[model samples]
Target: MNSSVEKCHMFHESAVDLLTSIDFCESTLKTSIFFVAFNPIFWNIISRLEYYTHFLTKLTRNPRTGCYVLAVTIFSLGLVRNYFFEQALYKQGVTGVLQNEVAKVLGVALIIIGQVLVLTSMYQLGIIGTYCGDYFGILMKERVSAFPFNICENPMYRGSTLSFLGISLLQGKSAGLLITFFVHMVYEIALKFEEPFTMKIYRNPKKD
Candidate 1:
């Protein structure tokens, strides 16, 4: 009974917040509805946790799969998060997020560069490469030796971080900045766990 009451209270509080931020929430709600209504069967087919985990394991067991999962989730959700945040900020009349025209320009430049770096990394890695195949014990045939790979070991992760920070700076939204910080935290955590595993995977390519 008490647990039920607590859940009710939380719902009530969230409703109140929604009421206060009606316009922003409405836009957010609409976007969510659209995505759900169009639920891409293709993504659902591939993005299942079970299949991804298996796929991640094949390439290397050193923890690359988990890190890949984290990266893909962050990149995909970051796009949604930033979109909602921008709408909220606009509705709230929060302007100072962009210090000035010059700042906005610089922010846009950063966003573009960051996006290119991120996409390049993703392309080089491919879907499973970006996500992970360890659950299936399926590893990439070989290491990626491409432009971005040569330029930086983890270009995608670094670019993604830059993209979020850039968007936050461009919009001058403190909320966006906070979310970006959270993202960075997740990535950092993944890095701590994944890097050593990756090194091991590279060092000892054959498990059997």
Candidate 2:
């Protein structure tokens, strides 16, 4: 009877440790998501402001250059966000059946598909169209209805979120799933502003 009680105590302690680790990981994941969400919203607002103020345009002396600057800034922030996401995953404790080979394979497949969608979309859009060049009077001739875009309205955002999920699965991290959901939410909110503003730019076809 004493041996059984000791075993139960050990099991309870282990479970408590696991729960504590999960809580820590979740808090870190939330911070990473916050930065990831903030990046797009920050750039979108800044780009729109630049469109009206021309501060970036005057500094760069070319609208395209300013757009490129913004793109680079966004890209750098993205790298940082990803780094934090990976760190959060590393901090998380693996649980359940997600650590199996089948899950790993599925995660790899999802990553591959996500990469294909992202790369193809970028190739079709080019740097100008891929970034917020429309804000600088650089507009695409028409909307691109390619393979990925044909399937979904925002393939890039969708693909990115998928990639995040894939990475989470590969790591068997539940925190990753939460972060992925936040990523999707942030992209959806961004689109609410981005899509309409882009359409207005095309409709007007004049730079301020």
Candidate 3:
């Protein structure tokens, strides 16, 4: 259908426009993007190191305590990254098209859906499962296939991407959208390393 084709074309054009309109040189935006890329890399490297060396466990003298410490560190960094993102959004210019009432409603819906997916996944996994306790030789007895996981694989990453996009729309910031796209790209790369390695860990768990 011509109408359907036009809609698809328009959607692509709008995304391109939003991306192109971003101020890439903004310091705050750069910082936010850096953090976006950094978090996953940091965690993956640290988790893998922990898996091989048990440094955190040795340091804490308890597997659970080590995991909790890593979780706290990750959580704190996430908060800092979010704070920087908020600050960057303030510094960036707004997109006129995303300032409309429809955009606001859509943003609200995406945020709600994103939060539901994120929170529910966390609940299903618990703190140990939510974080990389598996790398610490602490893993769930079985796979989790419920709620958000049942609906989608990698719900946390998807939900996080949705949240970033939602907030970008809510703020009408084209820079936010650009940063969010990179956030997603980084996550996808992280997953490439993560999923296979995690599977290997589970398939041939460490022997005591």
Candidate 4:
């Protein structure tokens, strides 16, 4: 127990040190972080609002169409966030520890694995499932429990977080790493809200 406590404490201190190395005040970095924080928050709020009000469904005149609209908006936002993250990486200082050839190789491997997980998840879920189609009253026939889902719960979120870390390492940027950490944190918080709400959605007797 003492050893576990010590390890946790050490990890916390190391994280603090890593964060201190980043330039939080830089415009690009701040913008990227804002989007990183904003994307999940925006999606969650919109999804829940749709659940409660069905305003999007009413606007589109169809559930699937509403989900598709949200999916396109989310996808476009992601592209913009990625662009800012790349721009921030260019402006940030490189960490010496991540400059080695081994880091580059590991980074490539991580990116490949992350993409596989993400792509496989998307393929399994489809666009509706990938986004918040269930919130639009369009749920899966049953719970998905294949391949990536069997191997990893919330595979898309996990895969995205891994990809962020992989890119940070590839770039050797402290700011990228810091932003990746924030991305992971935001996902975790989003999940806290998402999981229970998703369960509630599926609890309706109409589901297959």
Best by lDDT: 3
* Candidate 4 error regions (>4 Å): 1-21, 205-208
Q: Which stretches of candidate 2 lie over 4 Å from their true place?
A: 1-21, 24-27
* Full ranking by lDDT: 3, 4, 2, 1
Put down candidate 2 lDDT per residue, 159-181, tens digits, no spaces.
89889989887887767777888
TM-score between candidate 4 and the true structure: 0.88
Please, what is the whole-model Cα lDDT of each candidate in the order they appear? 0.59, 0.82, 0.90, 0.89
lDDT of 2 at 48: 91
Q: Taking the tens digit of each residue's C-alpha lDDT, what string does model 4 give over 114-162?
A: 8989999999999999999999988889899997999988999989988
Question: How high is the lDDT of residue 195 in model 4?
Answer: 98
What lDDT is obtained when candidate 3 is compared to the true structure? 0.90
Question: Which of the predicted structures, 2 or 3, would earn the higher TM-score when compared with the native?
Answer: 3
User: What's the distance in Å from true for residue 166, model 3?
Assistant: 0.4
Worst 10 residues of 4 by lDDT: 199-208
What are the TM-scores, per candidate, against the unseen true structure? 0.56, 0.85, 0.91, 0.88
Q: List the residue pairs that clash in candidate 2.
A: none
- Residue range 86-135, candidate 1, lDDT tens digits: 66445443334245788678778889988888899889887667664532
lDDT of 4 at 8: 94
State which candidate has the highest TM-score.
Answer: 3
Looking at model 3, residue 27 earns an lDDT score of: 88
